[model samples]
Target: MLRACAAAFIVAAGAGAALAQSQPPITMAINQSPWLNSFVAMVDEYEKETGNKVELDVTPFGGLLEKIRNSVRGAQGAYDIVNVNSLWLSEIYSGGFLAPLGDVQAGYGLPEGVLTYGDTTNWDAEAGTFAGGGALMGVPVNGNVQVLYYNTDIYAKLGLQPPKTWDELLANAQAIQNEGEAYGFVPRAARDSIVYNFTPYLFSHDAAFFRIAGSGKADVVVNSPEALKALETYVKLATESGPPGPGNIAQGELIQLLATGKGAQAIAVIAAWGQLEDPNASRVVGKIDAALLPAGPAGTVASSAGHWVAGIPRNVPPEKQKAALAFLDWFAAKERQVDYVRAGGVPVRGDITGADLGDDAAFRFIGAYSQNAQHAVMGLPFAQAAEASDAMALSLNRAVIGEMTPAQALNQAAADLAGVLERNGFAVTKLPDL
Candidate 1:
């Protein structure tokens, strides 16, 4: 039986070797995330099957863009595959750094429902295609959405219900803090992550940084009434109930605070929810549950998608490109995605929802994530997306650190984005009256 199993595995791997031969080793650049552990585990198997070397260059999230810029500008071909956040798609695609996957996708013909993991609430086919649906540019590998994580024990002890609205959320936080339970909540406030942390509130209140005009201009609207309401609400929550020195907090620190039971609740990315139930990493094992973000007064519940998409770089040699594309298809297949989920990686394949897991902590956490996907709002798409986002992040940080009032911060941010739009050749008319 053992020999038969080994023979079958080798047979299954034959296709990998058939894809290419005598090609230079392939390289992939991706951000440092917990799921990298699973990817590392699969490398040996991939090597055996493909008879080719594969190297991964994992870097901190902040350093990813600089690496891409340097490599692509130099035409160094240092990486064959590049992992990109959904937010980075527009900027990277506009630079022509990625090779369109039209031929490769047609040959592979990846089945439908396989790629439908994250929010498609605002997904546009043209954004993922070239020349208005000519070619595929990227493939989704992981999904992220915002969820409210709460300490079940604390809520039960205080006879409190999970908050369902903004007012209820704030009131619960104040009540929890008043009773000396834990820090009422924790939120990522560092400039690098603050925009994602705050956007859910902005979307919930129907506010936006800018809207794309029909003529392809960005109409700055960050200083509108709806934006002010969202900003003030986010600031008030962080100021009144969040931990001291929140301006320094990032995603890792927020997870640490929650896992150690120092925080009673948080609105955070669903990808990190597994940490609270990890026996080796958490003091709050079996005591945490997740739910959708609280709604705004207008009954809007919104979230932001943080999905990562992979694409081949234009610099790779033709033979090496074929190998890289084959590996990409194999790695993102449904079987591997299921294995990834079992290893605590975030699932992006639609078929591997929480229902596949037994009734346990993992199931409970992912259930919230699956439901929240329906409300995700992919941000505005444009070449200056990252620049505008950076400006907004700084404004959020300023408000959090008490350097500026929410209105002052937002007004300045709006002016800064307007300048960015104008410099990018997007004629900015009068600010929209939102």
Candidate 2:
């Protein structure tokens, strides 16, 4: 494994060089994320190497979409590059906001590891199917995936090994709870948290939200028996072993709980690992370790990927566009990628899974994280993905708070999801009865 950007270095070689020399500062619309500091460090390195100034229009995660949308919709888009998440990538692509990655670049072919990202990196614009069948879109700067994190000190003190199955995880949680030394677990349940936090549970149970049937059809499997079981395990893990008033816990709170040494175990994104090692914000520094998510009743270890992609807007000026694309090439180079990881960024290169973590033993998490990400499933890839997620998010929150039984909540969510697909012009037929 190597630490570096592996995107195909494309052609036109030196065609864009002269134009990029005098290009305006490349503007990028990106969100504030756990890996942002590392990203910025890479950006700084790019500037120092290429003399290309970059303006990062950083905003909250939720606000990023609107900002990118406002820019991409205009005649001449505001930003040169837009950072998109797998969850809503279809929205940007389907709207024709992004130009194909090869349109304005001069780089080598994509690295084998980069192609492992599949639809997150490529798509079929004509067929409207996301199978990496069409042109490449962008590089996956963040190879984010869900993994179980445990406090090594706590696990050793209690003589507990990292759980390999959901049942074992719950048992460990209960054991930690009985000890009263720290909270057994922490779950993010507030406002859109359940979808991301609980996806590994759903996937481990062999459940999926939707299965694309064809270019214009899909089957909704969100309320299946497997999903119900997954949901049950999710709620049980949170309420029985998690901290008090678990319903209000969100991403920040979950990280805070673990970083402050108040939590023993939980599942979180690989990108979030940076916070655990930050000396100023984390008391659990050097005590935390990560592993693949435990297997579910179906004996599957699965997780959700929320990798972030970088794309150039079609409407941006040629010089700015070239500069932005070149920045991507510079940022992804092997040397730069190693530096990126060393600065606290997750590597998107599958080849890097074997890289030595230097003196930091904590970087062992990268192996687990990268291995898990290679097989991780995405949240959704349809243009109406946000609406679909909202439909389920409501039900998930209700179900988590015990306002509705798992059956009732998922049933309602499935029904609403069907309507969303139908309205979005997808012929949705299959429905699961809970």
Candidate 3:
């Protein structure tokens, strides 16, 4: 759409084998989000260089999954590329709707230092492993991972350093809340975000929802003692330090709290770091920064990974698939990625980590992005992921609303998930109580 940005990609061309003349115009269906500016700029660069039109049919995030599924069921998919959230990989991978990028990568090859993020890339339908098994379903276009976002100015005012353990974190939050200056924390608790946002607590407590035992088997542990403790701590954080009506707090509300300088700290996705630094949209510009999530008594730190991967539809024409790969190849190169980050894109390339981003507060979150990605865990990595995650979400919403105690909520969620797994023909085991 913009021709001026083409200069950024002028010299970042791929080899001849990756390109072809007279390629048809391709459309990619993606969701509307903050990082979209970077992707749009890159595509603009591609159109200028190859003289092939690529349309980005931006859609809402809520229904993009169903739209992509519907598109791929027909003889010719509606779009050449589809944006897939890492959470939905199990369903997408199981349906075989996406073309395996690894098959074609031997030709032009992935740029050196590009990461595959196995949860988004490799998959094995038969083994129930969404993490990896040789087939590359997609390339991560967004490197979204959760991190602890804290008000740096507030911390300095209170003589607080970033906490290193859950106890220390709670003490710091309580101290900030005591000052009555701002909310000590803000939690994301909407049905869609709850499971993901709850994962760090679950994992750092050394608890889990389920663990794949073997092919088609899952051992459910969502009601374990460790899980109960994690849930109790989560409730404490939200009710004691978060905004009123924590159950209604989603991404939009949480962002509003941080951007308006009403929140002191919260664990949220690193992608939203851009909004907190936007001078036009935020009152706290240059006041917020990120740090590693505090560890639990188990001595582990965990963050949920919400990265979105881009994949070519199996039903699109061969030329379009080839063209999509070509775009991805150029898009993921280290040179282009550097420019992408400078333009507000999340860093997906391994090489982007540790590079100096200077004093720009807008790009400062890149450091946290690198740190969180290392400890990130896929919350639900199974074909029943969507169904089971929704179960967790509903229970979480109830807990924040005071409708259910943390233990009751978790137990019900565990049982509900096991039932869903069984209905889906997966053998399930409830972990023994301590």
lDDT of each: 0.73, 0.78, 0.81
lDDT of 1 by residue, 127-198 (tens): 331232335566666777789999999999988898889889899888888988698988788899888788
* TM-score, every prediction: 0.81, 0.86, 0.90
Question: Which scores greater on TM-score, model 1 or model 3?
Answer: 3
User: How many clashes would you count in candidate 2?
Assistant: 14
Q: Which one wins on lDDT?
A: 3
Q: What global local distance difference test value does model 2 have?
A: 0.78
What value does the lDDT take at residue 104 in candidate 2? 74
lDDT of 1: 0.73
Provide the lowest-lDDT 10-residue window in model 3: 1-10
What tens digits encode model 3's per-residue C-alpha lDDT throughout 1-434? 22224334344555532463456787888888888877777777767767777788777799888889899888989989888888777788888898888655554445566665535577876776775454777777888888999998999999999998888888888999999999998999877788888999999999888888888888999999999999888999999987899999999899999999899999988878877887999998888889989899968988888888888888987778988887776678776677788766887776665455556556767677777777778777887788888877888789988999998898888888899889998888996543
Model 2, span 13-73: residue lDDT tens: 2322333454567778888877777787776655554566887888899898888899999
